[model samples]
Target chain A: MRIVVDLNRCQGYAQCVPLAPEVLKLNGEEALTYNPNPDDAQRLRVLRAAAACPVQAIIVDQLDLKK
Target chain B: MSSPTNGNALKDKGRIVIVGASLTGLRAAEALRKEGFSGHLTIIGDEPHEPYDRPPLSKQVLKGWVPADHTKLPRMLEVHAEWRLGVAATGLDRAKKVVRLADGDEVPFDRVLLATGVRARQWPNPAQAALEGVYTLRTSNDAARLQAALAAGPRRVLIIGAGFIGSEVASVCRELGLQVTVAERASAPLAGALGEVIGAIAAEMQRDAGVDLRIGVSITALEGDASGHVRRARLSDGSTLEVDVVLASLGSIRNIEWLEGAGLAAGFWGVGCDAGCRAFDIHGIVTDHIFVAGDIARSPHVLFEYQFLSMEHWDNAVLGAEVAAHNMVCEEIERRAHLLVPAFWSAQFGVNIKSVGVPSFGDEIVFTQGSRKERRFVAAYGRRGRIVGAVTCNNGKWLEYYGAQIARSGPFPPHPAGFDLPGDMRVVPAEFPARGVPTAAPDVVLTGHDPSERHAEFRPRAR
Candidate 1:
């Protein structure tokens, strides 16, 4: 599974970090660091983290799809 | 009208109606389609615009960094649903499974999701509230109007109430170099949400930022000029302030009045729902066809001693909508629980304020880390001996750590993080405002103590 977070839209609420700890992390207060791809075993956790984002900055498996 | 069927009878081929086309409604529609529900979907909204993000309206929009019209929420998936905008849901006929609309229309459905949310409370006096300079920030239009008014350069801006919205607007005024005064009835700003201890810190932040802070006072009356524009505000302490703009940031009101005769467990606190987001009847019996989400959903939390909680935060709305959508389409055994630990964030006075769990449920509080004098700290709230909530001001990097402790119902004064400890670790009263004081306590409400007291009168044959 692949995931991408729009850094500009991300406000570092850190809500996603707790939901997907291994894949996503907050470097400091505002800077967010995350893995772009992960094993399918963590799909549900990644999706939940994506949905819980207040700004909906996280996108899963939509990187290649055209708008 | 057809009778309501058992939960499993209608899975993906039935009609589904969703009331309120905001964040929760839009997310639910997207989730419903993702859950493989190929049914006819209808979304009804009173507002004309499509679903939009509301958080930025007070912060970036008011600051003129972002336009109000550009706050629309991004569409995650293509939801091919019938859209009904600029029309209000007048009533609900549970027996007939139909939603009455204001434009003399009726929409039938096998299942429905109510995400009506809340509206900003208006000034009490109609005439004074109708004045030219009076405004309340809730929708995109309100932000646009207020932004223009601020850009016009009002002589002095008087803001009533010191809630999150009010305080955020005050922050924007100061950033714009406008003269602003905040009048609050509580002992300190944010006393209703974070309690007096943390509220005191917030009060200092506002004052240090050049805000004319006035506590323990309320605006008794608003005097206006002959042109129907607000000029001066009279205070309870016999003082008047000359002002050109007035913002009544007096919190919000739940949008559940239209469901009065619907026989749902709805009242001043909001509509009641179970763990699966199923709406409860007047007799506390869960209904199969109706679900609740967003700010209008009041459900019990296992973490907070199973007390029914109503959370008006972005996280709760999104999480609750997904759960409600899943339950609406799946069988009972395949349903999921909406067990979201309440969380929220506010940016004001150059500080990033964030919190997890229900802060109002805690009786005692202690600053565990960071420096309070510098306005960058983390305070943990404890009830009995368990940590119930934590607030971080400009110290949100530790929010996830504290949130973990709250989810586990960890011990109070939770063993210090082994670093950045405060000089004094003494626990003190949280000092929440007394009941009956109209404050910003709506963000997280522990509705009633007795579960049985939440039920309404069941008049089965009233119609």
Candidate 2:
């Protein structure tokens, strides 16, 4: 799975931080700093982070080897 | 979990894409899961941050009592879905059943929810807006930076636009022991939302709070120092105010530009939707797959004769989200309507101000309980003989009763309510003059422009 974020629209609401700490983290200024790639073990947490976002800026996609 | 192989099973479940990661969007996702929606859920937002509370931005957060980052809203339950953060939905391809992202990616969906909220309207002058000392409060970072500036103890703060946010900012400045000057283009504060009679009381409150309340004046230009820091502000009345910091509480612009070619019923007033939260197209045709909620959702109110109404209140977002969510998954026979009465509250200048119903919708107002002179009162608003709205200052306990009256379409003047009237109980015209240009008393305005102009602007744009 791969995750993508648009920095311009993100207001740093941090809804993704609590849901997936490994993927989404808040910087010193409290801006939404995140990781686009995570281990498979944290897949569920990343999905939950995307769903919990108020501005819905988190996007997760499934990777296909055939494609 | 194994993927569904049955075609009939997959047909029953459909994907839902919600834009604008706002309070309404989050709540709707949660409500969808709770209501047994097992379809693919994808949420997209332009803001990188998660959904947070906005009301606190002007109050506790600005007052330095609470940090802006700490104002995050509490989630009631878990919502399982895909998240698309920090990316904007550039276009809505209805035919393709996909939302085009700014990054060129597309998310396929069977249903879409438009929850893109409003943004702070900035100063007209780009140079003035770029000044270090001039600020506008809307998002968390705005509040955070403003709070830090206020903590530094600026000598004086000049607040332009005496609306709710402006007034609240002034109140916070006073509490912080900093000199504050409030310049209002309107004659009295809150005249836009509450009318002249009630606005007069609010004007008195500000004057008593030691605010340099300047009414009927417009800011001509902002004078900045060598470092581009605001030093003073010049008004149209041939007067200048010396200040180190300035806060512009002009108003907000709805997030509708991205939906330009979406062919949806989206405009400056917001995206038009049916009572069931279904979005409408430019031709006034309702679309079942696309819904709207929060500040961006404009739907008709049964209590207000089905007049399409849009509210920016916090409560409206939660209620509208739940309704939108329920309607998204339920069958037509089981779908519900989003008809919740609007309510909002604000804390400023040591007074707890709360209002129930749409105060601006009323034509006449009456003092139903308490005394306005005492700085505590419950004023009832009526439209065409029916109670439509009510505002309370330090007397919010009576709002529930007034809200019920509004909901039931109760009568005007409400039969005295075991309280003494001003001898004449007749409800008179509220006399809410145009905002921006001052004429008489104070008023809380919902929009920056005059109410009449808003109506004119909300008309369907020519093709």
Task: List model 2 lDDT by residue over B1-463, tens digit each.
Answer: 4322232232247788899887788878888877877888899988888776677678767877656775444455567789898999999988888999999999998778888899998987998889998999999899998999898999899999888999989988988898999998878887888887887787898889899999989899998999999998999999988898899998887898788767777877789999999998876888978899999889999998899999988778888989988877776787888888888766677766778888888889988877777767788899888888898876665677788888889888665667544444557788687534322222212334775653111333342
The deviation in Å at residue B267 for candidate 1 is: 1.2
Task: List chain A TM-scores, every candidate, in order.
Answer: 0.88, 0.82
Residue-level error in angstroms, candidate 2, position B243:
1.4
State the lDDT of candidate 1 residue by residue for B344-433, as single tens digits. Answer: 877788777888889999999999999999877899999999999999887776877888999999999887998899999999999999
What residue runs in model 2 are displaced by over 4 Å at the alpha carbon? A1-67, B1-12, B419-426, B435-463
Root-mean-square deviation of every model: 7.6, 11.4
Task: Please give the DockQ score of every candidate, comma-separated.
Answer: 0.07, 0.03
**Candidate 2: deviation at residue B83, Å?**
1.8
TM-score of each: 0.86, 0.80
